[model samples]
Target: LLEDVKTVNIGNEMAVTLSAGIGMDGLSYAQNFEFARNAIDLALGRGGDQAVVKTSASITYYGGKSQQMEKNTRVKARVKAHALEEIITGKDDVIVMGHRIGDVDSFGACVGIYRITKALEHPCHIVLNDVTTSTKPLVELFQDNDHYEKDLILSSQEALDKVSDNTVVVVVDVNKPSITECPELLHKAKTVVVFDHHRSGTEVIENATLSYVEPYASSTCEMVSEILQYIGEHVKIHPEEANAMYAGIMIDTNNFMQKTGVRTFEAAAFLRRNGADMTVIRKLFRENANEYKAKADAVSQAEIYRGAYAISVCSGEGLPSPTILGAQAANELLNIRGVKASFICTEYQNQIFVSARSIDEVNVQVIMEKLGGGGPLNIAGCQMEDVTGTEAIAIIKKTLDTMIEEGDL
Candidate 1:
């Protein structure tokens, strides 16, 4: 086998071929190299934490080095202040919003903005969509407070009626285009701002006027913590707001073991000082019998890919089973001693959804980005509109093989 091998020539350089029958189809070496350079996506479609290299003829594997680079507190602090300063020069009339499927993090970020905007006296409307918020108890927190505004939940037409050039829209928790969580508010806006901790995959809604996209932060609540510091004099961290943000922080960090950071702890501590109750947070995350069973089944079927990585699939008729089930499975996979990365893919509403997580050493964000999705290095996701979970798995493996071939291992 060694004697049969030959050093493959591309342009000016030569790379040894792995005998997968890779060759150009009657094309010049230069043209093929350019073609390879252009069409080959160095990342994505793999389970992540790997790379892909495609020449004219074949693709092959390299595996398992997934953590993203660690962040420095000083650098993050400076960048945060710079972003805050850019918006300080001109405060405009705006509506605060979040994804339609509201979670504790989304609601927490919205409330953080509401408090600041209320102090700024901006005419803010938080336009919620449909009955997406029907399952949340946090709604009661806002509704009970007469000071917090709550009249804007409406139809897509109603939301569209409210947008204008001066109408600045701020989206929290997620930056993806499909607002299945809040589609109406996104549709009518010309200017938008996004503050999210999740990875940004391929699907998008143009660009926001101001976007603070950081996958390193633990949660949207952490990003909101930065914003609250910016508006230091105007607002206080109320108990309810603290509880909401704390719940998000704890959930994303998996109780501070998987992806927690110094800032994460600091934010949680501040919220605790404001009187956040852990018992109430426990109540919020409690799953019904159906949800618990769905999660357990997904975890049981999980398989280890490389020695360090694990992956599983959860197929369902709707979004909740996949979304909640995927995260729960990922958390469960982490329990295995050698496993550093966990990926769960499931079918939902005509789309294939994926959720990936890693220990502090792996960057799931970089891997997810290749699949047109993004988040912090430790946790991320992607959505495939016209594919099944099985097809998605093949794409991931081939991409991994190619990444190994290219030495992005």
Candidate 2:
């Protein structure tokens, strides 16, 4: 039904799409209505153009093949920014956090939020547990520095202990609570806020005072940069802070080549005008010898499955951040001709991490969702436990075959 509805053309150059939600097994009509409301929100959050069915047991999705249209207006950003300012001003303090296994984008968004809270004259601390090799260089700039507080960054336990009733917990880069740097802080704080760019999933931070999640945005840093402008005219962005946010946009968009839009460039320009130095960010992201070799090996060993999917595995034995290498390898595999999508797997911390990427031919998010993961349509990932790399490949192949047979790919 959804596919048929999606086929309805309004004019010669355009077509209409529909999103729906169905609820079942509810005790009462009101309960079912609430369920349906949540389901519809999930459908739209996952980029619309789909149907979502929610029962007591599970949630199912259908017909989410189309890309989400970007909003040209900045009205939503302005409203969200005002709301965030109000929340921060009312709070006594703020605690900022991002997803686990911190990446450059995640930490950069944290820095942006930190700047916002400080400009509002509220105390703020960033909760970061593990800093990956890619983010260490950027993080070192603020660690133990005279310009920032000594307690600027804290561990999960310290953040949990410091969170108070009047403190506002701002989660950036990720919306899911399970993968956040500190989930316990959510329960400890009375107020919560979320700012992210990834498409939403079934799991999300509940009861957020402010939730600004834009799937069309290039990165969370881009979203935060826009919000920073609306916070106040006097809000200043230091060079290091601007560089951090700019690096995030650069990393997520693959250096402005992928997922680049007018707003994306505009956000980059905003950071640039505020003293973002591309040369410094480039130096911060320089690859070491081991990382370079590992990425090259993964690409050289890639297998083009069905002449459209490229699959490979990276042996990141000596690399400080194996998952980062795997993700980079997935991006590199897209250079191969006739490869519509790519998947690079790496064994890290007793789990198999699969990084999926594509240009436009495939919806990698759906593919990763099948394996209990979610991300944007072009870039996604999944983690598998107790599975060998070879077995993981076989499972992915079977999944591809099934999706192909069902006309889903």
Which candidate leads the pack in lDDT?
Answer: 2
What's the TM-score of every candidate structure? 0.72, 0.98
- After TM-score superposition, the amount by which residue 381's alpha carbon in candidate 1 deviates from its true location, in angstroms, is 1.4
Q: Which residue runs does candidate 2 get wrong by more than 4 Å?
A: none
Indicate the TM-score of model 2: 0.98
- Each model's lDDT comes to 0.64, 0.91
**CA RMSD of all predictions:** 8.6, 1.1
Q: What is the per-residue lDDT of model 2 for residues 1-409, given as tens digits with 9 covering 90 to 100?
A: 7668767766745557799998888888888888899899999888898889888778888878887887778899999999999999988999999998888889999999999999999999999988899899999989877889999999999998898899999999898899999999998889999999888887889999889888889899999999999997768999999999999999999988788788899999999999999899888899988799889999999999999999999997867789988998999899888999999999998999999999988999999999999899898998999999999999999999999999999
Cα deviation of 103, candidate 2, in Å: 0.9
